[model samples]
Target: MKKGTELSGLINKVKESPKTLQKISPIKPTKDETQFSFWIEKMLLKDFKLIAIKEDISLKDLITKCIKEYIKEK
Candidate 1:
């Protein structure tokens, strides 16, 4: 039999044995597929922390605010 047929037969055999097999699906992040984040060193992070405090906002909130404001200005 062809490789595809052989694989399909094997899959069907596995499917026939419900107690011996389980299906799995991948879980993906919903946020923009192109979006990404990275870690910074503690010292640099502390600097942003200071900026955030000076700006009177949480670090996470500050990032959103800054980016939004930048986009608005542009």
Candidate 2:
């Protein structure tokens, strides 16, 4: 098939499809909390969990403590 024909077909199909509006939830940040996300290696995450367990602290607390120490060192 020609590229123009394929493109027109795709456009027509898209035009025939129904559109829906989605309801999104708003994020509210607390006094001391904000949301962030990043990727980490599997083994590194396992090691972090293990260290947090050994220290008898929540994973969040462990991460916060490590970040604070890192900033202090810098």
Alpha carbon lDDT of each predicted model: 0.84, 0.90
- Point out the worst 10-residue segment of candidate 1 by lDDT: 27-36
What digit string (tens of lDDT, one per residue) describes model 2 on residues 1-74?
69999999999998996866887888666667877789989999899999999999998899899999999999
TM value for model 1:
0.38
Name the best candidate (by TM-score).
Answer: 2
Candidate 2, which ten residues in sequence have the lowest lDDT sum? 27-36
Summed backbone clashes in each candidate are 0, 0
